[model samples]
Target: MTDIGIVGAGAAAAAATYVIDGALPDASITVFEKSGGLCGRAATRRRGDVTYDYGANYLKDDDDRVVDLVSTFDDGLVEVAGDIHVFDRSGTVSEGRDADERKWTYRTGLTRLAKHLFGATDATVHRRTRVERIARSDGAWTLTDDDGGTRGPFDVLLLNPPAPQTATLLETADWDAAARDDLLAATRDVDYRTVWTAVLGYPFELDRPYYALVNTDKEHDVGWVAREECKPGHVPDGESVLVVQANHEWSVERYDADPARNVADLADHAAALLDDERLADPAWTDHQGWRYALPESGLRRGARTPAEDAGCYVLGDWVAGEARLHAAVRNGLDTGERIVHAR
Candidate 1:
């Protein structure tokens, strides 16, 4: 029987788990996630009866494989129907070009994607277990956790962290020094766009023609503003929840600032761009800081060669060269199939 271990519980990891489980049903799979929640940056949260996807706005129907995979989980899927308006540098809002395509999320939340993928497999996911180190011996990999516990002897290992974090892991891994150094060099140069997201809720409905507003020129402080009401069952009939994501520059500037202050600033920006004043005051607010939001570059060609040759694999949206959820899922599916064939 094959023994497979995966690090991080993001979209790619979930997709990989789903594919690997289907291809190799007899394999023993184990996953380690540092955080309490799954799906990484494609995060979702609920406040009282209102559910919202605060990180990734929604998954697009860009890949046929992803479409087929999600189709199998019809009970958890919810298609979003609305237009996305663009806010130019001058603060004028217009309809966006991509709104013609369909957007999707889960009925419960985006996390259901991860839940459904993992639920289909016999894999055991260990949440809140941060892997501190990875080493190889006897053609097997051993993982050490931050809690001083060790788990390992797996035939294969998969890493699903962001590029920078993955670089750190490669740097500390007790593997071939030259290969590790090469991977570190390549991954270190994979730049990322940081984002600070704020979720605001109101007791009354927000009447707007568009469901979202994005910064087309990238000159605005807010990168995107989306309404939770666009997704069915996310918001109460009479209430609304607005998710505001700050641009890279603004997010980097205020990432360490007070959450209340940062959220207020985003709400203020949203009010101006949406031409609505009531949005400046939200009944409840939630905030999250994504240090590594989207990857600016894909994985270097030579970066994965060394790992793959050593029975290790790296998968993520960053590795796929596109930060979209569809890209990540596609990469994971491809990587899982490659692993299955390789074995």
Candidate 2:
């Protein structure tokens, strides 16, 4: 039995495993996650009666692969076709017919999609287990956790961690010095930006439309605003929920700042956008900082292989050109297919 080890239980890892399970039905798979939960960047938080998508809010179904994968999950996903308001830096709003472009979201929460991918299988998932190092010995690979203990003799290993972190992991592996340098150079040239997501719940409703894509090049810090209540199954009746995404530059600047203050500032800025004073005070608020929210530069596809020469592969949105959940899932599926076929 070939043992395939996958890192990061996010959409990419889950999707990859889902694809691999179909291709290689008897192959053993294991997923390692630094957090207790499976969702990597697709995390969600429930505040009161409202469930907020703290990570990826919505997915654009522009590619056929994404649409096909979404169709597999019947009740797990819902399509939204409504008025989408796009605001430029000058505060000028534009509403177009493209608003009908399909936007898919999880019914209960984004994490539901992850759980669905981890369906009945012998795949071992180690949560809250941080991989300290990945090395090779006697033609087999070994993965070590923070405690210096190792899990090894794997047939394949997948490095799905963030790009920056992937470089570090390769350094600790037994790759040729030249290969290590090349991997470092590849990752060093790659850049990533941060984003601060502020999830707020208000007692009163804001007059703004359900989905507002804002491009404020001035004092405002938010780039996109999604009214959580507008999405089905997210909010209860009469309750208002909002998700504000801060611009990359602004999020990076205040990445380590106070969470409460970040949430308050986001709420205040959103209120200014709607010119409504009621939004100035929200009933419940939470903030999450994502240091690697989006990839700054595109990575060369097929440029990377397993650093330890093991069947382990690397997959994620960062390698797939976009940071959206759909892209992550597609990337995972593609990676899994490639691995299974190669075997």
Give the candidate number with the greatest lDDT: 1
Cα lDDT tens digits for candidate 2, 144-249 = 8888878866788888888888878887776555545665677656788788998878876555554655564534578877788777877887778878888887
TM-score of each: 0.98, 0.93
Clashing pairs in 1: none
Candidate 1 per-residue C-alpha lDDT over 96-162 given as tens digits, one digit per residue, 9 for 90 to 100:
7775788999878998889888998999999999998998888899999998888988999999999
Off by over 4 Å in 1: none
Give the Cα error of residue 207 in candidate 1, in Å. 1.6
Whole-model lDDT per candidate = 0.90, 0.76
The best candidate by TM-score is 1
